[model samples]
Target: MGESVLLTSTPPEHKESVIVSSAPQSRPWDVHRLPSAEGRNFLVTGGNAGIGYFTAEQLAATGALVVIGSRNPAKADAALASIRSRVPGARVRHLHLDLADLSTLKSAVDGLALDLGRLDAVVHNAGGALDDPPRRETEDGHELMFGTNHLGHYALTRWLAPLLSAAPAGRVVTVGSFAARSERLDLDDLQSTRDYRPKRTYGRSKLAQMCFGFELDRRLRAAGSTVLSAVAHPGGALDSLTPPRPPVGAPTPGERLRGLPAALMVQGKDAGAWPVVRAVLDSDVQGGQLWGPRVFGLRGQPRREPVPAHMADPAVAARLWAASAELTGTTDPHLGFR
Candidate 1:
């Protein structure tokens, strides 16, 4: 239930940047044209609100059975109710999950396995831009942001890979960030134990996610698994930019000031969810492709875009894959010796 901190501080120049409307606009592939998902199932992390909630709501509105993962059951319940209120007959459920704590994943996965008869996609959308002090570690002993944003999802994906493979058109969609484009990778110290700055660490984690998403696609294809993998970024989408709904909690003053850049530079979450929904539902999109907004590197319709230079390195990706496996204890044996 903890919110992600803003990835960047507001620049003085952003004060003069133009403010735009938050309404959803026409796009090539948009929520309005989303295909029916009546028989399909999906799981979205951090789905209680923001982009994740909208993603789940859009899918469930079109008849997909959605399972939202959140650490707070009350918030999840509120989200589910909100969905049903907006889209009558939406088939939605919530499961408690804390991405910063790995010990809780087993029970979550077990519960999901029982609930899901078939899964069409899993969206790794749970992550924060919160800037905790340097070297803060999760219950699992990894740096908090990296562990929650990348490692926990890594473990969750590995655990759920089989069920996804069984579905006729399974996909794994991991959310990246525009920060990946401007940031450099520190493969040697991915945990950021050596030195930790919030934005840099967040960018590194997103870069790692981009690498993992593409590499997993290659591995799945090489192993002949039916599931597909794709990555997407939300550009500058922020909760503040989205049209206000029922209030959950008030934003801190820092959060308010930080969101000013977004008010000028970013699109709202409704449009931001496009690329993610596209990655999950677009039959034409290929595995390993990246999607994001079309303009200002901040907002617009979804389009295929290049992966970050660091993320595109095959050797780096392989190393990251092995390291993730070691970190999550998901070796080939754990993956059915694939």
Candidate 2:
């Protein structure tokens, strides 16, 4: 999180150069008009607030049974309350799901399978900045950023794959970030044992998440798995979902000044939810396709393409696939064996 220290003191002209130029637009006219899950089940991580909150609320308003997965069940209920307060009778239930801890992932997945009877989609959206120094690592010893942001979801997806594949036209949607350009994969130090810089580590983790989505698509096709895999990025929408995570220490004057412009351009989490919605629900969207915003990289209507650089480097992606399977220990014993 303090990787800002790695950057030179020289201030960049803009905090976020990618700016949305066009007004928000939906897809090719009802092209993604999914059945709204009327009898289907959907699992959304970090569903207590912000984009997750709004998207789940919107889906529940449409009659879907949304299983809200969050680390904090209390906060999840509050998020559900906020939605119900708005829609009068939203259908969102709460379950504890801490993405940083893989152990919790299995229990939550099992509970969902038993409680919901079926799961149509699993929205892998729980993530945030590790504001503290980069010293902390997961109990599993993976670097904190890569572990929580990427590996946790990776393992969760692996654990839930069976249910996802069983669902009719199951979709596993993973969230990506615009900052992935900073992702420089250092396979030698995948766990940050040799190096650790917060922003770089975060970007690497996001890139790994994107890579996982694409590679999973290939693997699914190879296995003839019916699940569809797609990736989406919120781009850079900072709404109530972005809790006021104050710095460990007071910020320098330059830091405050550098962040002022971004404070203005950032839209609400609701505005950021569209691209992900398109990715998860769009019928025309193909596997391995990355959906983002058309304007400013991501602030307007969702599109069917990815910004350059993010989709580059297939080699790193393949390495990431092998590393993730090795690290998580969740891969099927029958498949993925050389």
Candidate 3:
């Protein structure tokens, strides 16, 4: 369920570059040293579980007022409880946010608008490869992975720009996937119209996510907006992004043995959460810093790494930005247009 490779996103020289040059195989982000996220307010989409959950928990532990934007209130509540028990006095709240449904997502703005106050950051951490199996559309009638992964966040962030811009030093980090290396933009099949293959669409959608995120940074900076747009790839933060699950069942002993490859390639969600934490909270971190694992990223410790070649392509990024604005009906006033 994969697509053919595109041009390698990594350049020849910096194929496996690390951002913190001296760091080795275990450069985990130290939550204790995280600066005063106190008094700041932030949001983490899909912040109910996995990387999203851990990110919210860690930030809140540092006393940041965090809102976990989850599609499910129940899951959000559970995540908050988990955080509070470990980090006493952690200030975290939950609200409804489904990346699949735009209207449902926007409703929260009016109901629980942060517009009254400045926002410190936002982590666009929700995404999936739902393009697997029978081609399906979200409730909004768009490709599942592309719509939820890219468009949903596109619209949400556009609306939140004012709050973000008003913050003292705002950061918006979009969570991208490593599959992006193999994905290229397909203008003709932006919605997977001509042909629908799950894995191909998933990778392409992720690639689109990175493009949109970086372009967003370019736009914000050109306009001289204080907002910093940093993009992060979870490397091999694996989960069920693309396909439908084939009912929960038992795995054979030998089938279980086959799980080792992904183990080598992927780390637990807790360990994988550091890159986003580093991107958001580390003061020395600069704008547009790319963070992930130093060792193959997918299944190792966290570090700042190079942006993939395709993800950094300007022309492709620009076209995707325009296309995103059209699809989401957001001019992105914060976008810097030269």
Give the candidate number with the greatest TM-score.
Answer: 1
In model 1, where is the ten-residue run with the lowest total lDDT? 1-10
Return the number of clashes found in candidate 1: 5
lDDT (tens digit, per residue) of candidate 3 on 189-299: 789988888999998887788888887887778788888888887666544321111121234556545655677667555556768887887766767668887777775
In Å, residue 46's CA in model 1 sits off its true spot by: 0.8
User: Which scores greater on TM-score, model 1 or model 3?
Assistant: 1
Clashes (backbone N, CA, C under 3 Å), per candidate, total: 5, 1, 5
Looking at model 3, report the run of 10 residues with the lowest lDDT sum.
240-249
Q: Give the alpha carbon lDDT tens digit for every residue of 1-338 in model 1.
A: 11221212324433311121122334345445565556788999999988898777767665678899999999998888876655546789998999888878877887888877568899999987656674678887998888999999988887787678779978899999888888777878989988889989998898888888888888888887778889998898876666444543335667767777767668778678878988887778889999988887678878889776677888988888889888887767235313
Clashes in model 1: which pairs? 4-128, 4-129, 4-130, 5-129, 5-130
TM-score of 3: 0.81
Q: Which residue runs of candidate 2 sit more than 4 Å off their true CA positions? A: 1-35, 240-266, 307-312, 333-338
Return the lDDT, model 2, position 96. 88
Q: Rank the candidates by lDDT, best first.
A: 1, 3, 2
